[model samples]
Target: MRQALERRRAAKAAQHLPHADLADVLAPSAVPEAPVREKGRRERPEPIPSRRGVAKPFSGRAPRIPNLPAFRSSTGQVQGLYPWLYGKSLPPVGAYMGVDCLTGGAFSCHPVEWLHRGLTSNPNLLITGVPGSGKSATIKGLALRLLTYGVKTFVLGDIKNEYAKVARALGVEPVELGPGLPTRLNPLDSGPLGQHLPTDPIELRDRLAEIHRRRITLLSSLLEVRLDRKLDPTEEAALAYAIKDISGEHDGNSQLVDPTIPDVWAVLRDPHPVMVEELRADSVKELRERIRPAADALGNMVQGSLSGLFDGPTTVRLDFNAPIQTVNLERMKGRGDETVAMTLACASNWGQTAIDDPNGPVRLVIRDELWRAMRIPAMVRKLDADLRLSRSNGTIEVLSTHRLSDFEAVGAAGSEEVAIAKGLISSCDVRICLAQDTAPLAMTRDAIGLTDTECQHIASWTGQHKGRGIWKIGRSSSHVVQMMLTPIEQELTWTNERMSL
Candidate 1:
């Protein structure tokens, strides 16, 4: 009983002993204190071992990767990261137009080459911009550059004489025509026929018929512009017969004599015997009465204010051999629009003969402010025909105006004049449009088939954006460019600025 009591007392004493600490109870050694790290100096992290097997690629959702900080840069610098965000450089050929605002590369354009390469369907180019928008400068620069490549440039009617200085610099004297100018250009003058004259009787006959047709066309245009009305069918027939008679009478010993406006005027005033017989008129007076209006119109051009220019034979023949030729009409500034249109018609016909030289050097014919002539129906028809024939004749014609509405204003809505104007615009394969007033944006967009993007681009152009324009080539390709001019070119092409000063 005493031993059992002693065992119980020992067990109770063991249970009452103080509990040992956790480290003493669990750890085999004393835990060391972690060393404190210095400020701003991070402790190196322990390396983590790579997973034993390849982790399956994310299947359900993309793994989130922490995005880096955003960066800001100028366009010039950002372009390096995204090259395709800009326009591609064009084929390095033709004239150096300027820098492509989008791609920041040199932009050159060659109408003929572009056509040959199938880049454009037609070689003709149409440029439109308001006054002081650098249209003239661009054309002048193009002409100068083309001259270096042995291409000939012919400015049909420069009412402002804007091209005179450039023509002089090119070593070609400009043929200035106006009311006090001694220079006279006979519209009836036979122009340079590039092809050899035919010796065969049949061929000769056909050639002569073509010549007669051209002359009649020219005369009709002149009279229509002067009279501000279209010629009647009977009147046209009479005029045609008179021209044929006069031209036949001048043909002697197989040596052709060129007929002048005076000859046509005289024939109209007093109908030829053959014309009288053909018309079946009782007398010359009756014949004259029937065509009195036509006769009077011809007389005005012969004896009236325009007498010195067209009545006589051409005092100065166009030298197609020259690299460039300019017909300056600055003196015609004060003249009525009718007179200006008539002169333009005559000059264009005269220049056509030279431009039709297929075997000669490629020619670039520029008609600035074409709206001045489009006011006349006859002029519109002539321009339309010229645009269509430009490709066949190896000529690239550049037509420019302030707005496309100029074409719509050619005549009343739905008139033939309007249709002809529209046809001319449709024939162009390349179009360069500078900044324009808001008035004609809608018409311009519709007429040129501009897309919403292109419309917005053009609309954004302001006066501050000089030398900048939208070049639309083919059906959908377009680029914004800034025209760069050489020192000499800028001086030669500078206009209105002097007047403004």
Candidate 2:
């Protein structure tokens, strides 16, 4: 017992010294609890201690939340209380994506809220910012995400070549609209685009007008073929008389008795035997009372009330995708020079046809650089008010512009750049910034109204951050998503041949 007791004493004294304390380490004993930080007179964390006190810093321990995992198993309730998070990274989306120029990646705002406000609720959205403010990319980015939801897309590549890239990537053919060859896309064909056009009276009138114009143009062109020459005013009048003759043939196809009209000379010589026969002078008189002015007059009214028609999924594609700079608007005449006529007619016709097709896909209408078309008086506000309700019935539109002032022409405010800046951004639910100076776009450190931390990050941003953008999905600005990286080089395509966009 004496030897054992002495041995135990020696082990106790040498406990922390090499192997001397090995056997004594197994002894069961009460552990004294470490000091816990008690709340001070102030509940908030204390200010950083002075240099010397840094080591002791108030409580030589971190707050409960910081040391939580080490102290105990995670509380499921606490985990549940916080929002959904993917991993240990600063942000999950960023882990997958590295933005253009900033170490700061995508943010995770409330998606449900933004989705409710931007897509599910408000059908009309006006996105305005200075030229190159990333507006076009923003639209494409939003559409890219929406496509995952199985939404159909129709873009009127008016100016920039971006939307076409998105469409091509998704498998939509590129169609160019011209004098005798305007492409008519039915919602039945694609499901959604059809319902957009025929939404209102103005839209209806526009549709009928386009059809009428096509019919008239076809007749006129047929007359020219028959005549083998460009018809002069007198020849045109004679051709009209000739068409009237063709329309008069009862239960029979067009076989002209007198195809002497200059425009009809070609058909007279080499008639597509089944060619629609011309209406004679006498019969044409009565038909003129009905169909004569329908094309021109209806086409004119569509221009006047354009904004009132853009409410839903209706669309008006500007000629931005064409050889734009070569297009001399001044030299254009009759219906050819009139873009508003086209918008009105297209919207009216599509809406009238698709409104009742229950199984039809959602409607999508695209208008690129709309300002050029809206310049003719009343078209601006027509788009804004009409576009609001378009999406509920699966109607959507892509409206693009290079100048922010263009929004004023459409009613967001005025041609002033400031009108675009004041606050419309909240409505730009899925905002994107592609390769543009944030300062010009009202997204500078001081512009977005950020908290101190965000401000600190923004101050450090630079231009290599091209394609780094913002995306808000729901109605009340709910979900904010941060995209760390986008496949920028992959989006590159070889198509901008036009100079105007």
Candidate 3:
């Protein structure tokens, strides 16, 4: 009966199961019939089509794959692949200048440091922009910040008295020059050195020679501006002799004898007896005649409209120890361009003397509206020399002007004035350019050697990017930046003269 039961069960099982092929039945484990799943247990769910088809969820942590090797790359290549990851920062050891729009990093620049690092060959800066482009504001901001770090500033030719408030804020007075102002600056003031007198006989001789040369150059520039013509060769020679004779009279004294305009005028009017005797009659007559025009031109400065400011001994002195000193020419406004030019020439000469000390504090000499002064060939030449010698004197010259054409406008094409103007531009190793008009933009590009990218940036600048500028130092690529100013800086540098309008 048991055997009959087993046979029945086996027959039922065989009937229920499907027939298998010999190959499947012989396979290891025989494709073990899918194990019966537990009741109420979940089966694998169907994947819903993702909106972004086939994309996996991005996790903050990267998933690891078995047997995968690591990958390596260069920072530069990676930065190229992801542009926003690049950041080029300058040395962080200077006053905060602004923000580098490219990398969004703070941009700091110290002209002295740049010189040491060889990033800039010279410590001179040229700031160019159209009017209302915030060039002045940028310089003012830089000056105020530098003062906090003990850098002295000498603002020569404050055409609009823009730095007057700044000077006062720094606890120094601006030397105001005009028709009725009490302040007077003798372009010939020797400052603390008294015409740079030295104890050594040879040194004194050299110093005297230098002073005489500068005096002649300054007088020539003044007379040229007054006469509106370049001095002839004979006129220049006669003036040189006159300056030499007058300086000889002051040679014996160790104390600085301030040479006044009247003294120089006297020598020019009547050739010194010694000078006259040294020359033949015809030569004397010719010398006197040649110097007359120059003398008369100087006479205008001493006795004419320009009399009070430069005629006498310096009534005001440059306080070298003071944090700031400004030659305020605001009062000279409406007096005609000639008057302004002469005043600027004299003021700049006086400033040069003031900062001549080798042991003096490092200076930041700012020439705002620089074109007004640099238009004069002699002045521009002196400026170029100053820029070249700035390194020795621990000085940095910052020149700001409205347009590059200002240099071209100094004289006729191919004239010395133009050459001098170009020289001044070339002396600067650091250039800060702001918004410009169409014509100026093109001219600046040519003058400053701007690339196509830089040209586009300058051309597109507008009201919305008022304080933005391009800084090109040495041969490096240009940096686009927005001048960053503190609230106090903005208040001090506010130059929107039309804001009241």
Candidate 4:
């Protein structure tokens, strides 16, 4: 046992020996030798001394913490409680919007770019806020910034000429349409579609039919806006007959010669015998009676409040190659909301046809004061159709209004028009909502599915600075983006110049 203890002590002492001394210490010799130290080499230090003069081992545990998987949440969910926890929700593509208040990173986005990236379902956008909450400024700044990327901006109906200055800055003149303006827009004008026709007979036939349907829909919408009600079955039939007769009279072999509003009005005024018999009318008088309301409404456009504008062929064609185009409807302000609504509807249809090319470059179509057009159910339907087609045409249509409740104002409570108008908001995947009064924001919150925190942010922004809004991307991503504008853009988007003066 004494020899075994001596060997164990030798093994422990050998651990502290130098390489040469290890062999000496392990060797079986009668005399024991101490560990040999190298010259100028310090010995190993002892364990850290304790205050009690006794070294204490590290007995503390790493606290029993459990590993957690990363949780995904929107800005609305986190209220930015954890900033910089995630990378950018969107890629750095398209226009430079501004700094992301949540991440302190620059936020840049465009509807078309996001759509191509599969970050958004559709390219359309819906902007809603109070009148002075920088809705127009956001649109103008983004539109101008997008010019660098070859995205064209077209204001379908600039009700207050808000985009006129932007167009001028882009070296393009806005088309002003109102009383005393020589500009005319034919609702039936075949736009880019007629300019380029398919060579195949089957394709050509389908295209022509599509054009016919569009024209009919436009005319029907105009009449409904004037009459203030949906057309009856007999009235719709009579109107369809009148449109067909006008088309047959002016249609060319290889091209569709669009019939003017006046031509359709004339046909309705004097019904052809075939039309009379097709409608089972006893005589032309009976057929005229069936279409008198529609005819009178059309007559108003040619001779009443809406005269000289849509009565003939389009005097000015839309230049799609231009960086920006705007239809100025400022003069229509005092003509009553109905006249303005009807006129805007026609102008919207005209502008749409001009940009409806499937192969055309990506265009940003802005519809300002969309609530006015929504007043007419037919116009609401037209907007719904546009939303559906935006995906195929690759057009990012920005629809701006004052409040979400404005959609409810389109028709009576629970009416089909109201449902369709609300559905329009649903079809848009990207919604930029600015500060709004708390009362209206309640409806907006429920309609947009905004989280409670997001709702508070938007409501509180009313007293905050301009251009501070919540940009909701897709279903989950929400960003508090402050839309920054350059000095030049500031001048272009400044709309309160008159008020400030």
Query: After best superposition, candidate 2 residue 254: deviation in angstroms?
Result: 28
Write down the TM-score for model 4.
0.82
Compared with the true structure, model 3 gives a TM-score of 0.81
How far residue 173's Cα lies from its native spot in candidate 2, in Å, is 2.2
Question: Residue 63 lDDT in model 4?
Answer: 38
Query: What is candidate 3's lDDT per residue for 30-148, written digit by digit as tens?
Result: 45598899999999887764543444566233343357698789875786678655346777877899999888888887888888998888989999988888898888888888877
lDDT of 1 by residue, 99-164 (tens): 988778888989988888888889999999888788998898888898777778989889988888
Model 4 lDDT tens row, 1-501:
999999999999888945565566779455768879999999888777443444335644343546779988877678569643654657888889898987888899888878878888998999998988999999988888888999998898887888888888778999999888899998787788776788898988888778778888988887877787778998888777676666663244665567888898898888889888888999988878878988888887779866967888999966778999899989888888888888888898888888888878888999999888887688899899989898887688899999988898988899998899989988999999998887888888888888787887786775456999889898878898888988999898888878883
**Residue 154's lDDT in candidate 4:** 87
* Stretches > 4 Å off in candidate 3: 1-87, 192-196, 227-234, 248-251, 282-287
- C-alpha lDDT score of every prediction, in listed order: 0.81, 0.38, 0.79, 0.84
Clashing pairs in 1: none
**Candidate 4, residue 435: CA error in Å?**
1.0
Which candidate should be chosen as best, given TM-score against the real structure? 4
> Tens-digit lDDT track for model 2 on 14-37?
866565354457763546689777
Superposed Cα deviation of residue 150, candidate 2 (Å):
1.4
Q: Estimated TM-score per prediction?
A: 0.81, 0.42, 0.81, 0.82
- Candidate 1 deviation (Cα RMSD): 12.6
Question: Using lDDT as the measure, what is the rank order of every candidate, best first?
Answer: 4, 1, 3, 2
